[model samples]
Target: MMYKSTLSVKKEIALHLLFWVIWVYFTLAVVDANGIHFAEMDLFSSTWCITYVVTFYVNYLFVLPKVFHPFKWIKAIAGLVVIFLFFAALRYFLEQFLTVQLFNVQNYNPGTGILYYIYDNTFYAARPIILSSAFWLIVLLVRLLDYNKYIIEEQKNTEIKFLKAQINPHFVFNTLNNIYSMVHFQSPNALPAIEKLSSIMRFTTYEAPRNFIRLGEELNYIHAYLELEELRHYDKSFVSWETTVQSDNHEIPPYLLSPLVENALKHGSYTAEIPIIIRLSCNDQQLDFEVINRIGNQKKDKLGGIGIDNLKNRLEILYPEKHTLQTTEQEGLFSAHLVIYFQ
Candidate 1:
């Protein structure tokens, strides 16, 4: 904790130094553009530079926070107005005194009226205030951007945790049901079913907790799941799987394809003579997947399924605008197509 705090302090100091260096350079350039020699302008430049620095910190550290709070608007505005007037008057007198006393420069007119003197001083002071306000706005913008980035990172972490929690429970429940059915029938595939379930459980418990996994690894998990489902259905159902993955090196969010496949198997019509078809194609840029199954006479509630809703939520969080998912039912057939674009 101490190390982190020390590092943060160092970073803040470095950033402040960098900003001041740039500010000085810009001020020098502007003075040079006005054909003013450095020796003659040194006092003028230094005075306003210090004035701007003071103004920026005063607004940034104190006034800005109050301004940001909507409930404190009246107090904040009143305070800001008072500060602005005070700084404006202070800058005018400071510059006048430094120029006249330190450099023996004289521009004051003793005969001038108080109102005219005040007006002239206020006009000169406005320049420093304007420059300070510009720097303060930049500081606010940088802080806002940093805050937005932190928020996005926190939201992403929360979404991944939620998805992982949902996936494990749903997957385990479905796989256990399949295993129970196999045991109840006293089928010869019961042992192999247990092995498949074990492998899937391992993947979900370990691999799926990660942010990303190789596409090939995910496909292998899907294969294991399909095999387990096949054992449960026995010879009563048929599945046709096809793939055209151009590379196994591609990475995707873990368990991304499992829910779609699970939904197909759970809701597909088993009595149909036509086999359920699942197709997956991938290239360097994108992945395309489709699952088509025969619909039974009893209409499957596709929209009402928790698995599908969970899948949609995960897709929205992970892929956002980078992927498309569509489901259609026509002529006793239900089809789900998904396309994901890689960055």
Candidate 2:
């Protein structure tokens, strides 16, 4: 917390210095163009620059916050008017003192009486207020943009958490049902199935909680799930798993690809002669995952179920335009193809 606060203070100081440097450069250039002596121009510009800086910081630190509060609109407006008038008077007096008293600038017009003096210098006094208001507007704009960025990040995190909660319960229920079926049949594979279930539970409970995990970790989880399914069906089901991963270092959203494999096994026809084929390939730039299964007489829903719908929502949130998902049903074959592009 302290480190971040110190960094913020440093940035503010740097920005303040940059603004003042630019102001000084422009002020000197205008004075020089007016054919004033270099020394006189320097002194004159420096004096008014202080007043401008003071006006800006005072309004920015105090008055601007009050002005932004909708409930204090009337009081804030009155305060702003008072602040402008006070600074304007100060600027007028300082200019007069520096030019007439210090520099004795010739042909300096001193208007008749206090009324004429106020009238003539009123616009000059308002210069600082106008410049300060412009600066305040810019500061407010930057702060608003930062606030919007923060809101978007928070929303994304909330959505991810909700999705994970939904996935875990659904996954556990399905896996438990598969295990129960194997035990009822008095299959010898039941013990090995329980061991694979332990590994799946560990991955889902631990790794799935994170926003992102290595592509390899997700693939390992998928392999474990497929192994568990193999024990349940035995020789009744056949799965052809092919993978060509160029690198395991790539990062992806956790449990992203598992749903596609799960959907394929759940809906696939074990009675069919052909085996269910699950193909996954990845290179440096893109990942291609395709799952094909025989439909038999069962009607396949192209839009998919809760798990697939959840997967789509997560893909949209995490990958957006970077991913493509296509489902095609040709003859009795149902295929789901997904391609994800790395940034």
After superposition on all C-alphas, the RMSD of every candidate to the true structure, in Å, is 4.5, 4.4
lDDT of 2 by residue, 1-343 (tens): 1112222557767877887777666655445566743344465566566666777777777777677765386876686686676666566656666566777752236664767665665665566666666776776677667766667767788888888888888888888888999999988988988998899899888899888899989988888787788887776357777889889878888888888888877787744358888898999889999988887566553557777888999899999899999999888888999999985
TM-score of 1: 0.79
lDDT value, candidate 2, whole model = 0.76
lDDT of each: 0.75, 0.76
Over the stretch 48-68, how does candidate 1's per-residue lDDT look in tens digits?
666666766776567666666
Judging by lDDT against the true structure, name the best candidate.
2
For model 2, name the residue pairs that clash: none
TM-score of 2: 0.81
Least well predicted 10-residue stretch by lDDT in candidate 2: 1-10
Model 1 worst lDDT run, 10 consecutive residues: 1-10
